[model samples]
Target: MEKRTLGTAGPRVAPIGLGCMGMSWGYAESRRDDDTSIQVIRRALDAGVDLLDTAAVYGDGHNEHLVGRAIAGRRDEAVIATKGGLVVDDLATKQMHRDGRPETLRRQVEDSLTRLGIDRIDLYYLHRVDPAVPVEERLGRPRRPRY
Candidate 1:
């Protein structure tokens, strides 16, 4: 239950984090048991493992909802990391599309925050890179032309 810094400026979190993706989706089938998942999450937190990684794309946002419920009372003790940029077709179909446009990123983050019931995400990562758009454009930053 040792704490470690995620990055130079990032917050310190437990060394082990719960990856909630598999709990809700992936592995060729969904095994979403909110009750069990919540227990596991609570135990992890009680054991001092505070980092929880999830994504809006997982189970088409169901995973985030579950995690939100699990961490409701102990939000201050956890570090939540969720990804954006990939949109799922539906909760059942699980089809995906990448959209890293700056506007989309901003919108997705806002939506994710609402779904997760958190004011701010401790860590946010782009789920996939969109090749059609430049990284600078996707980040809403001006691109310095290469010489």
Candidate 2:
């Protein structure tokens, strides 16, 4: 499989990535089997698919755990992508919270690192923008809305 750079400074990864959301939880009833999911991830990597997309909010961090297990021995060969910010509870009510607060981001990133068994995440995204707080304030920087 061919490889491509994710960003100007990002690492090269296979063109295709495995979206592990289904293998973890969410989006209908959960039927995830850890062993199968891990095998699938391994197969993807063996086939040259290097990017894996997951989120902290997925399965309340269960997804990250699965990803961690799947990529245990192949960390250097894959690009891990995960998201943070959205909070969910037992009620399954997803509260879209903008937690890009620098401190929060730092903490979440650390937690994600621990869960994913990786020292650094290749990509991270804010799952949702918090309506209660201004984007600039939440992000701790100034920004202009793109038209």
Candidate 3:
């Protein structure tokens, strides 16, 4: 498996990443099989595929849970990449809205950490940018909370 540097200073990862959305949600909901998905994720890890992409909005956080289970004993072998800032309006309809406020991101990050069963996420992405909020406010360095 060939590896490439993510961005200029990010971690080196395999050329191909395993997206766990379809396994838990997205396509063919009736065919969602947890056991098979776990096996596939494990196989991918064994094959040197390090990046695993997931998001909170996928199945309203189901995908993160599935990915967490898949990478349970192999945390060091994976680069868990997940997204936030998109709140699920309706899981059945796959409708969601962007919420990039600092508080919302903080909550989402905490929730994702809990759902993924990880101390820290390897990579975090904003699933969608909220036009109502400035990008800097969402992506900027964390400011000391004004109590």
Candidate 4:
């Protein structure tokens, strides 16, 4: 498997990653299958595709839980990447609002960690920037967030 660094110094992962959004939300809900999604993720990991992309906004954390279950015993084989900074307004419609407030980010990170059943996330992304909150404050401190 071809591997590339995420940034200049980030973890090296397969060039292609698994985007897990459609597995838990979006597209046709009727065709969504948890079992299949889990299998797909596991297969990707087994094939050396370690970057698993998910988001807290995706299925309002449902996707994270699904990814968590898929990686269970093979956590070390996968590099988990998930996003936050969006608050789901309605699960059915997938309506969400950007909430990059420090408190919100803090809570969301903790919630995501719990849902993913991981002590630390390998990569955490801010889904969207909240216009209401200043970028610096929303991100916490300096250029990067403390957490």
Model 2 ranges off by over 4 Å: 91-96, 133-147
Q: Per-residue lDDT for 4-105 in model 4, tens only?
A: 988777788999999999998898867889999999999999889999999998888889999999999998888989988999999998898988899998
Report the error of model 3 at residue 38, Å: 0.4
User: After aligning candidate 1 to the native by TM-score, how far in Å is the CA of 59 from where it should be?
Assistant: 0.7
Per-candidate RMSD, Å: 5.2, 4.9, 4.0, 2.3
After aligning candidate 1 to the native by TM-score, how far in Å is the CA of 106 from where it should be? 1.1
Candidate models: Cα lDDT each: 0.85, 0.79, 0.89, 0.89
Which candidate would rank higher by lDDT, 1 or 4?
4
- lDDT preference between candidates 2 and 4, better one: 4
Residues 1-147 of candidate 1 have per-residue lDDT tens digits of: 677887665788877788989888886454557898899999999999899999989988888998999999899988999998898877677788898888888988998899889898888888999887798888875434211
Tell me the tens digit of each residue's lDDT in model 2 across 4-54: 877665678877789998886666534658898899999998888989999
Candidate 4 lDDT score at position 138: 78
**TM-score between model 4 and native:** 0.93
The residue pairs that clash in candidate 1, if any, are: none
Clashing pairs in 4: none
Q: Number of backbone collisions per candidate, in order?
A: 0, 0, 0, 0
Off by over 4 Å in 1: 28-31, 141-147
